[model samples]
Structure formats: structure tokens, C-alpha cells
Target: MASHLDLEEQEQLEQVKAFWKRWGNLITWVLTAALAAYAGWQGWNWYQRDQAAKAGAMYDEFQRAATAQDADKAAAAAGDLKARYPGTGYAAQAGLEVARLQLDKGKADEARQSLAWVAEQGSEPAYRDLARLRLAGLQLDAKAYDDAAKTLDAVKSPEFAGLVADRRGDALLLQGKHDAAKAEYQKALAAIDKTQDYRRIVEAKLATLGVPTVVEAAPNAGAVQ
Candidate 1:
């Protein structure tokens, strides 16, 4: 019985050896690939953390220069953020700050350029939308009515929908299209939340355009109370 059991064990060992011989290379390759991928994923996470830290430091430098009103220093830091961390929110925010500084210095064209960069290449949707809105405002002030319209057309976020319509109304009014402007302002008024103060501004605009804003009636107290 011991000899029979030994023979069975030998046969089982031979079968395992044959199976390994057929599949060992593939298994080794798969494990090597998996380990390499895991290592790469870990390295990528480390690289992103390092990049964010560096970008945040540079953004701090920009804030300091901006607070000091040192235009040149602020511009330098903003440019650096743009060049090295274009994928970061810091770059877009720095660009916005630079645009504000430029506008404050009466450099309208320079401000437009900075805002255009942010509008086109910002890393966040809200930043891009804000840049576009500001750029459109600048364009409107410059009497580039058509350009302002074109810029407003690019604003797609629902959060900015009312503001975009309002700006479009301003552009139309500037072009002497009173009826079109009134329609746009009406749309703005409807899109804006009633509880917010901005709707008052829109309502005032509609009033100027000969559209009487309907005062909302009070909600019935029994309903949903």
C-alpha cells in the first residue's frame, strides 16, 4: 500500500510539472505586466501630488505679488504658472488675476488677451465660463459688439445662462436693436432666480427696454405648508 501511494504521488507531481511547463511563461509574463502597471500607477500618483504642490506654491507667489500690486512680479508668476502648470486650476486663476490687474492699469487689450487665454484653456468649467463672460464684457466696452455676441454664444454652462443672456442684451442694446435687447433681457429675467438680487438688475434692464416686469404673487399659504 505504501508503494502504491508513492506511485500515485509521483504521477501527481509529474502532472503538475507538465502543467507548469505549458503555462509558467505566460503566468510569469502576466504577473510581470501587472506589477509594472501597479508601479506605474503609484509613480503617476506621486508625480501628480508633486505637481500640485509646486503649482500651489507658485500660486501663492502670484497672490503675494498681486496683493502688493507689483504688476511685473505678478505677471511673471502668472506666466510661469501658465507655462509649467497649464493643466492646473492655479494657472487659470492666475490668468484671471492678471487680467484684472491689466484692466486696472488701463491695458484693455492686454486684459483681453489674458482673459482669452483663460477662456480658451482654463482647467475648470466655471473658470472658463467666467473668463468668457468677462472677455465679452471687455469686447462690449470696446464697441466690438459682434465679437461680444460671438463670445456670449460660446458660454454653455447653465449656471451662467442668465448672465450670458443679460450680456447679450447689453450688446444688442449697444447695436440699437431695442426689441432684440428687450427679448434677451426678458429671457434673462426668467432664467435668473427670483430670490437673488441679480434679477432686480435684470428687471431694471427690462424696464429700460420697455418691458414691464410682472410682480410675482405670494404663494398660497395652504399649499405645501
Candidate 2:
């Protein structure tokens, strides 16, 4: 009986060995891949955090230079941020700041260059929309009505719908398309929220264009509480 048990144990050991021989390499590779992927994910997260920290520091430098009214230093810091962290929000904000400083210095062409970059390549859609809006405004000021209309047409954010309409109205007004401008101002007024004071400004614009104002009714006072 002891000999028989030894023979059964040896058979079981051999069966185990056969299974390992069939699948050992595949199992080892699977585990190695999983470990490598986990390490890569960790390394990527660490790299992103480090990049963000560096970008934040550079943005602070930009803000300090802008506050001090040093356009050259601000532009340098902004350029550094854009070069090192173009995927970051800091880069987009830096572009806006640098463009503003350029505008303050009466460098309209330089401002347009910076704004065009943000409009085309910003990492965030909201920032891109803002860049387009500001770019349209600059084009309007430059009497590039066709370009301003095209830029305003590119704004896709619903939040800016009213503002886009208003700017489009301005472009049309400047092009001597009074009827089209009035229609756009009407659209702007319709899109704007009643709570926003900007609605009143739009209404005033419409009035200036000889569009009769329709008084909005006051809200009910909640049935005497």
C-alpha cells in the first residue's frame, strides 16, 4: 500500500509538471506585460504632474511681468510656457495675457498673431472660443468685416451664442447692412438671458438701430408667499 501511494504521488507531481510545461511561458509573459503597463501608467502620471507644476511656475512669472507692465518679459515667459506645456491651460491663459499686453502696447498685428495661435491650437475649447471672439473684435476694429464675420461664425460654444450674434451684428452694422445688423441684434436679444445686464445693452443697440423695444414682463411674485 505504501508503494502504491508513492506511485500515485509521483503521478500527481508529474501531472503538475506537465501543466507548467504547457503554460509557463505564456503566464510569465502575461504577468510581465501587466507589470510593465502598470509601471508605465505610474510614470506617465508622474510626468504630467511635474509638467503641470513647471507650467504653473512659468504662468506665475508671466502674471508678475504683466502686472509690472513689462511686455517683453511677459512675452518671454508666455513663450516658455507655450513651448514647454502647450497642452496645458496655463499655455492658453499665457497666450491671452501676452496678446493683451501686445494690444496695450498698440501692437495690433502682434496681438492678432498670438490670438490666432490660441484660436487654432488651444488645448481647451472654451479658450479657443474666447480667442476667436477676441480675434473677431480685433478684426472688426481693423475694418476687416468679412474676416470678423468668418471668425464669429467659427464660435461653436452655446454659452457664447448671444455674444457671437452681437458681434456679428456689429460687423454687419459696420458694413452698412443695417437691416441685417438689426436682425442679428434681435437674435442676440432673444438668445441673451433676461437676468444679464448685457441684455439691456443689446436692447439699447437695437433701439439705436430703430427697432422698437418690446418690454419684457416682470416675473410673478410667487402667489403672495
Candidate 3:
């Protein structure tokens, strides 16, 4: 019996060795690739954290300059942060802050330049949209009516659609296109929430133009809210 068991165990060991001989190199390569991938992921995570830390320090400098009401310093710091870390959200925020500071100092041209840069260079859509809106406002004030219209047209957020349309109406009104202005204003009114105070201003604009109110009734024709 011992001799028979020893022979069976030897045969099983030989089969295991044959299997390893066939697949050992393939399994070893697969495990090596997996380990390399995990190491690469850890390295990438470390790099991102380091980048964000550096960007944050630069952004803090920009914020401090802005808070001190030093427009030149704020602008300089913001520009540096933006140039060095344009991929950071903080950089875009700093741009907006700098633009606001420039505007408050009555530096329209400088503010417009700042806003234009933010509009063009911001990594985040929200900051870009805000910059575009302010830039359009500045253009409108400068009597660049068509340019303002074009800029506002690029703002894609539905939440800002009404305000953009309203600004377009103002531009059209300035250009003596009364009918077009009325249509744009109507679109603004339609886009705005009825309960919003701003809707009253739209209503008043439409009223002044003698355009008939076309408020569509809610779908629940007979039910009370």
C-alpha cells in the first residue's frame, strides 16, 4: 500500500510541474504588469496632491492681495497664479476677484481685459460664463452693441438664458431695433420664473412696449396648488 501511495503522489507532483512549466511565465508577466499599474496609480495620486498644494499656496497669496484692496498687487498675484496653475479652479476664481477689483476702481479697460482673459482661459465653465457676462456688460456700456450681443449669445447655461436674453434686448433697444427688442424681452419673460421679482421688471418692460401679455396657463387647468 505505501509503495502504491508513493507512486500516486509522484505522478501528481509531475502533473503540477508540467502545468507550471506551461503557465508560469504568463502568470509572472501578468502579476508584474498589475504591480506596475498599482505603483503608477499611487505615483499619479501623489503628483496631483503635490500640484494642488502648490497651487493652493499661490491662490492664498492672490486672495490676500485682493483682500488688502491693492488692485495692482491683486492683479499681479492673480496673473502669476493663473499662469502657473491655470488648471486649478482657484486660479479662475482669482481672475474673477481681480476683475471685480479692477471694475470697482473704474478701470473699465483693465477690467475688460481681465474679464476677457478669464472668459478665454478659465478651466471651469461657471467662471468662464461669469467672465463672458461681465465682458458683455462692459462691451454694451462701450456701445459695442453687436459685440455684446455676440458675447452674450455664447453663454450656454439655461439658468442664465433669461438674463442673457434681457441683455440682448437692451442691446437691440440701444440699436433702435424696437421690434426685435420686444421679441427678446418676451423670450426673457418666458424664461424667467413667474414668482421671481425680476419677472415683474420683464412684465413692466412688455407693458411699456404695449405687447400683449401671453402668460400660458399652467397644465392643471382647474386644480389649485
Cα lDDT, all candidates? 0.93, 0.92, 0.88
- Note the residue pairs that clash in candidate 1: none
A best-first ranking of the candidates according to their lDDT comes to: 1, 2, 3
lDDT of 2: 0.92
Candidate 2 per-residue lDDT, tens place, 1-225, comes to 999999999999999899999998999999999999999999999999999999999899999999999988988888888888999999999899899999999989988988998998898999999999999999999999889888888899999999999999998899899999999999999899989999988989899988877766678745576
Candidate 1: misplaced stretches above 4 Å? 214-225
Give lDDT tens digits, candidate 1, residues 56-132: 99999999999998877888899999999998999999999999998998889989999999999999989999999
Best by lDDT: 1
lDDT of 2 at 170: 90
> Over all chains combined, what TM-score does candidate 1 have?
0.89
Tell me how far the alpha carbon of residue 172 in candidate 2 is from the true structure, in angstroms, after superposition.
Answer: 0.9
Task: Please provide, for model 3 over 86-184, each residue's C-alpha lDDT reduced to its tens digit, 9 standing for 90 to 100.
Answer: 887888888888988999988889988888888888887888888888899999999998788788978887788888888888888888888999999
* Candidate order (TM-score): 1, 2, 3
TM-score of each: 0.89, 0.87, 0.78
Off by more than 4 A, model 3: 1-26, 211-225
96: Cα error in model 1, Å:
1.0
Q: TM-score of predicted model 3?
A: 0.78
RMSD, each candidate, Å?
3.9, 3.6, 5.0
